[model samples]
Target: MGFNRPSRIQENALPMMLAEPPQNLIAQSQSGTGKTAAFALAMLSRVDTAQKVTQCLCISPTFELAVQTGKVIEQMGKYYPEVKLAYAIRGNRVERGTKIQDHIVIGTPGTVLDWCSKLRFIDPKKIKILVLDEADVMIATQGHQDQSIRIQRMLPTDCQMLLFSATFEESVWKFSERVIPDPNIIKLKREEETLDTIKQYYMVCKRNQDKFTAICNVYGAITIAQAMIFCHTRKTAAWLASQLCREGHQVALLSGEMTVEQRADVIQRFRDGKEKVLVTTNVCARGIDVEQVSIVINFDLPVDKDGKTDNETYLHRIGRTGRFGKKGLAVNMVDSQYSMEVLREIEEHFNKKILKLNPNDPDDLIKLEDIHN
Candidate 1:
């Protein structure tokens, strides 16, 4: 609501979403581009204050994202106090057996499906609009396709649908076609995908064990205000966080295995500047925004189950920083020949060369400061 102007995605997609005889929408843009506000405003506009039943349903991939989206909806709808809001995320305050009387419901797909099918807490027939925030991640990482489809089936056939994400794979696009019919699509070209505000770099390590040493050296040489180190697995994230903590670095570990409360607390601590670094897996790669994070470290480059390069994951990981057109840096640690090849693939995909970092030369580390300035 405080925004003075619309972003490119908003400028293009918002008008179509609010147009007469509402049509489905599929939008792809970089992160921190006000995609949330765009969809939130569309949902708010469609809601009728006189009706108390759940008219708009917004589903996110994670509990943290659902909570965050709920806050955004609340803030944007501050002028409309009569529009009740409810969240169906884990640890939510909505009491059991209490009919969700709210006019709008924001939640994870699984929880929203459970409440609709099993608990009967939400009346799907009353929902007039459906929005999927971070749709690619919801369908790809969380395996929410089946649940989301089931929930959609419960809603009225005429309900409006909207899907938004920063990156969408070919497989996800096929799924979107079946979920959203005759959609108005807004997508960015490959060249426009990666954020220009980020200064990307890579550090070469002789072996996998040398990556830890290189990470420490980079941390020691650079003056990082706040940063996020991404790993390939929860085990690696935990190990790296412990190693960094022992080295007198303020660090926090977050992964999907932890309880929702623990994850929320870790994110809060990182956002509040209580933690200097957050070590996490792909769980935080999407829908989590921390403006103070000026740097992103790929302790382990992302790869698929078959060990192929995952370009979408790579973009979202770096998108954690360089938020909202702000200057940022991303450092990739390449230890093996395979990892180097993967890094090469990422560079080629984005059509940008990642600068090399030399730990032996403090001058290389100073380049980060220069880029930020």
Candidate 2:
């Protein structure tokens, strides 16, 4: 998994990161694009086993991502048995003093900061590598900006810093540059340009009430092996999954409301192909990898307070499919004029036309390469 095969992102970004004199790395890639495994293997390969007091620290915005990344590190460390793995998430009952001083520490920024402030378990002096996973979300949500600054201040100034994000925001860039020493920017191919393998289509509906009808039509029309239905809120995600399940579509729901184990189970079911469609919020719209997902349905268009979803969000929604060079489909259900505008913006940003198809039309599957060519 390390040397034999490299994915597109890995092929482009890994060597620069793993170079002998490692320049600080700032990587921009889409979700499900194997960025985690790239950095995980890199961290494992770089950490010194004999002198260990917390050689690495990886921070994440959400507990789910932190735990998921920590799990990946634990698995990767199997090749080297000497490295120890530890986590510092809130609500976990792990012992304080001795447990957290392992070779690798992964946690949400808040918990790590709290433990350090309280003088519970961590010693930042020994850290040689610092990673900020999902750097965009951390800045977007304002979860722990001050804490991150404080943590960086505590660590040695010479420590190597690596920041990873599916989308690069200006705030992320500014903050990362402040902490990293002349970081090397590594951005993978734009989602639309490199994602020619995904078939994108949209259906226009009259109003919000017509969405249910369109949903049924899509269900009847497509053979969905594994699909993700994106919604604006957690309540909507749960409701849509319930409605689809009642309509006899094997479905599951994911949101911030779920416990860690529950989220893990839902994701496992999705990966195993036991559940055909998953209804989730924007929380699952970044840094999540579901290989069996062949389709993504936008039940409701996402928007910030200014009524914009931004190009990054659009790319992430469609990126759930067409992963690893596989052919996939993305369907957007448009109900209002604003939705149409959003679609136009996406088209212009990607420079690729999206196929407009009727739900009842039998001839809806359009090849993406044909549209681009």
Candidate 3:
């Protein structure tokens, strides 16, 4: 609410979103453009204070995002003290068998669906507004798609729907057509997709094993506030974290394999600046915003199980840094012909050139530090 001026997405969509008769919305904008604030405002405006049942439901792709969105809603609704909010995420302290009396409920799709269908914790019939934050991720991922569809089917007819994400792939767009009928669409052009605040570069390695040395060289050559190194698999992430720690670097690991509590603890420690480096897989790719992350490294470029380059994943991975117009850096480690091909595809897709860096030259690596200065 302290915003002095409206962001582009907020300026364009907020008016139509808060019109007299609510309308379905599908918006695609880059991260850190105030998309969360836009949706949070729309969700809060629809809450019925007198109703004891849940009236507004916001679902995200991950537990971290769910908790973060809930906090945003709370912070924005500071003036409305009576606007009750409930979080239905893993490890949430909400007691079992408790009927959720909150006016707004924020959670992950699977957990929210369970509370609605199995636990009967919240009455779905009374829901007035449904928001799917990071809609593209929830719709494109394998298991998450089915869960999101099932959750949507359970909601009452005529309920207002809002879907927001940084990307809306063709498949995701087709799926959204069926879910949100005659929706008002807002999207950014391809040229406008990449963040101007990020300084992107790539380091070519002679061999696969040389990547670790290249990463360490970058760290030694620059002063990184905090960095997130993205790996293609959990095994790789664990291995990298261990190797970094053994080399006397402060590092932590996060993956889907860890228990929810473990993931939460690692994220909290990193966010609090207790841990300076976090090596993770795609688990922290989307909707996990950490403002202090000035550098993002692709230890392994993101690819699907089929080994094809995942452009959306790449966008989200780099989006982790350069948050909210802050200066940041993204470094890609390309050690093989295949990785180079993938990097080329990403470059063509984003229509931006990623400069090559010679890790052996401290001058090239010092460019990362220059932006921070």
Candidate 3 per-residue lDDT, tens place, 167-258, comes to 77788888788677679999864533465777889999866458889988988888888999999888888888888898899898999999
- Return the TM-score for candidate 3, rounded to 2 decimals: 0.92
Report, for every candidate in turn, its global Cα lDDT versus the true structure.
0.85, 0.77, 0.85
* Candidate 2 local lDDT, 112-190, one digit each (tens): 8766566557778778788988877777776587778788888877787888877656787787887777888888876
lDDT by residue (1-373, candidate 1, tens digit) is 5688887888999889998888899888776888888888999999898877889999988898987888788999899888999888877765678788888999898889988988889889998899988877887755598898889888888899998876678877977887888899998645344558888999988765677787787777767888999999888898888888999999999998999999999998998999999999988987788888888999899999999999888888898888777888899998889999999999888888888988657788677667756
Candidates sorted by lDDT, descending order? Answer: 3, 1, 2
C-alpha TM-score for every candidate = 0.93, 0.89, 0.92
Clashing pairs in 2: none
| Per-candidate clash tally | 0, 0, 0
Q: Is candidate 2 or candidate 3 better by TM-score?
A: 3
Compute the lDDT of residue 358 as modeled in candidate 1. 83
lDDT of 3 at 120: 88
Q: Over the full model, what C-alpha lDDT does candidate 3 score relative to the true structure?
A: 0.85
